[model samples]
Target: MLGNLFRAETSTLQDPSDELWDALCGPQSAAGKVVTADTAMRVAAVYACVRILSETVAALPFNLYQKTAKNNREVASKHPLQMLLHDLPNEEMTSMDFRTQLMAALQLRGNAFSEVERDRAGRVHGVWPINPDKVWVGRSEKTKRLSFEIHDGDMRTLTPQRMWRVAGLSTNGIIGLSPISQAREGIGLSLALEEHGARLFSNGAKPGGVLQVEGKLSDPAYARLRKSWSDRHQGGANAHRVAILEEGTKWNQIGMSSEDAQFLESRKYQRSEIASMFGVPPHMIADLEKATFSNIEHQSIQFVVYSLLPWLKRIEQSIFRDLLSPVERREYYAKHSVEGLLRGDSKSRSEFYKNLFNSGAISINDMRRLENMNSIDGGDQHWLQLAMAPITQSREPSSSGSSND
Candidate 1:
């Protein structure tokens, strides 16, 4: 049934439209650099942001959980879907590799696609990632339902059930807008600045200065003088070298302007901007200008809460919606364990665990499990402070009806 539903057709010989051609060629930024997902990643900040987000998500523990009879939830370790998601997504890739690829796609292209391969019983057996660039999303006019057109070797159509999609921020719910395409101008400017700096250094790290002479020289003499100067002191290796002046010629050095001096500052600001574009904290990408020892920990917490939480929720919900069947959805859901990212220093964590243990909120075994330590034989029992009493009991008069001597 699944094979029949997915129909493939060979492409017909036709000229591509201008829009299609432009997409194939990629967008040219104002800085003259071609800005695509692949090209944007060449920028250091862009690469760092994507790598941080993708690898962070990939390292997290993602697994399916089932609702228990006691109204709690537990990891469905034996479930086929659980094993597929937590250990391996497909034969070709481990769960981390698959998740990292999909997340990187989401960070770069604003969308990720995966084909859901099901067994004879309609249980999901494997998941295979598809390149976002090769898949086009559209709604069918007849049913008004979403469909995916995969442009691999053959043009194949996949129904919503057969294809899993995770989209980033979007104006419409169907298609996600590419961050690289939207922020091309700023990224292009960064690229241009980087290139300019490289060229400036290559030209001896100084602006072209005027050469004063006693009298006007012929064109050939001027040409010969210019070529001689360039050949002696054009590259970084020849920078700051002593020059011999003859024939009453004088070298007037040009000092760098304020704007030129601020080139490094501009590059730093652009790095911050790129980090902000991906919702990453500047300190996370090694931008510690405003970060301090006192507040860097707080910033890391903010990164997990403000930046990483939304992406985690998005992926978790998408998995629940696209991977689970209607009946399975009622009882099972997916989640990523963010405990490790949110964990504080040893002192802070010890205090936290102490408070929770005293309040009987968590058992010793639970804390051990969170710390990835082996549980003791009797660590399952929850403990509470024995001296703590209810407010009403504290307010009551003594039964002996006498004051303490």
Candidate 2:
């Protein structure tokens, strides 16, 4: 059923032009603050957090399932929706790349959008992503329904049904509240700190100081002296170089004392704040000031639970609501397999599987499947703890005249 849609074909879509990119990049937020994707990525912590989230999500597997009344479990199937979602959203991109891009957009802009492609029969065949910056959501005056308008040289309006939008928290539900817009001060502070550090390191990695000369010089002489000093001593390469001062000349440190500067502390604090805004643990973004072995492991779990789960749920619900047909919706649903992320160390997993296997909660085959190991013969049988007999059986007399301890 999905063969035609999944066939190999090249996409004819062109890259967004500079003009379009610029239009989408800035000048829209109510706070009058503009944070471009490129600018946000300049911050190492922000980049790391975004990468951790998007890569984690993109690596996980997704499945489409149909529930049958006769069967107790959902049966996995190779439906067209699965092909479009798990294999190829469009001919030009693979599923992982598409999801990674989408996740990055969501993380940075607090919104993501994709256009649905349908054939003559109105059956969805493909999904094409649209830059979230270029798309704006509005409510129709007549219909009073949410609609998305895309600006790509020309303006085109799309009904809510035709677009898949994953948005962060919003008050109006029509448009998402941008994290960059809401936390503009935090982002600005982080960027300013980074720029300050770069400039400080660039100018010989020293604090600005005053050169006390014995006698005042003409403006031209002073300018020439200053130019020569910078030319010979400025930048990281000239760091720690000996300065040649003229007779009766001395250098006086004028800027804030390094002890009071607290540059590293301020940068670290900003990193924590930025990570907090995204619900990511500081250690996940390499801020290891308070990180320990135990806490790091816990933070890893916290990242998946608190940070990525909401994003995953949003995508799952969006696919279920927008991609599935009316008939398919009744039976089929989309889900991301988070088991890989939830798995613990090998020893812990082994103990967990052993408990479940002994208690008859899970079969040997199920344990093997979870570990990605081939099932052995007779592994389908369930095992119960022999020591824990039924209460009624324990009270009954033994057939072989066994004495109770």
Candidate 3:
């Protein structure tokens, strides 16, 4: 489905630059680890952070609005782009699913690529997500215009204008620099440690140890003894089972203890490091070692402001630049309504809506819409604070000390 979405209309083709193809197919991370989008996601911290960010971005409602000329108020309106964005981004996925996968690609690969399907009128009809793993971006040496090469089963060159590209933080503007690439060493090390620990637990919940036989046996006997012992006792199921030591047999523990090795601490630290690399709060990624009640709320807000804002902005700008036609660009704009995520608990939200309603900043209907409740009749009327007084009416006592004037 994704492959068909990214197919180019024109047969015109260009080969991906050798350097670009190599970097994409076998990118080396700062940690000297081979970090592909799929492998990076295998790291638990990486997966958690990506899920947190992508799901948050996807959960927010995206809408198109037109700016009214008189009051400059934003009114919800439909555009040709809405047919794709608000309903189905592609034939296979709904809007949320499309955004979630798109954002996930962006989070892991530092770029999300899509092809904008157009009708005969040259208006956007659908948006198809392209797998970042299968896509490469390069600039033409002569024209300097960016081109996308999508390698599904076959390679095809995409017209840059027909592609929707959102790039993350980058030293070079053409392609996004991946966070996974930069932090791969730390994340890779953590993953290695985790696998090693799991293996340790699996193979009898103990680190390497030595088994000594009191009497030296013939080569075959020694081999048989070793294999027998392992088959009987080497595994978690055999852990803590009483071992009957025969004459001249002993067991000696070796290797550092998990504590001495700082194994658990290393895992925790690496989790935090991975979260930091992705601009996610460690607590959000389930690293709550230092999280407190007061700080968690602040952290949640910071996730929205610091972590997700830039990504959301990237998507928004891409939508405006690539999806909107010239006329639509003049009056219509796309924005994600993040109010739902930013809203506090019921009490806080109630107070917030109450204040807004009382101050006439938002009408009853507006509040209802935000709460996902049906708008009541006449709820559009705005209300202001009830108390007021004329400026000329002096409330202070005059110099004569009269109670009333």
Tell me the whole-model lDDT of each prediction, alpha carbons only. 0.85, 0.77, 0.78
If candidate 2 were superposed on the true structure by all CA atoms, what would the RMSD be?
8.2
List, in order, the clash count of every candidate structure: 0, 0, 2
Give the least accurate 10-residue stretch of model 3, judged by summed lDDT: 5-14
Tens-place lDDT per residue, model 2, 124-202, is 7888889986775655556666667677778787876689888777665545566765676677777877777888888
Pairs of residues clashing in candidate 3: 31-185, 214-248
List pairs with backbone clashes in candidate 2: none
The TM-score values for the models, in the order shown, are: 0.86, 0.85, 0.86
Please give, for residues 1-405, the per-residue lDDT of candidate 3 as tens digits: 222322343222223342354455565544455666778788888899888888888878787777797857464545667656667887899988998898888788778898888888888888888888677665565675777778888888887668998888876665777677666678778767777788888878878888898667889988987887788788899888787776677889898888888888888888888888888998888778899998898789888888888888888888888888877788888888888878878988999999988888999899889989999999899989968778776577567755663
Better of 2 and 3 by lDDT: 3
TM-score-best of 1 and 2: 1
Best by lDDT: 1
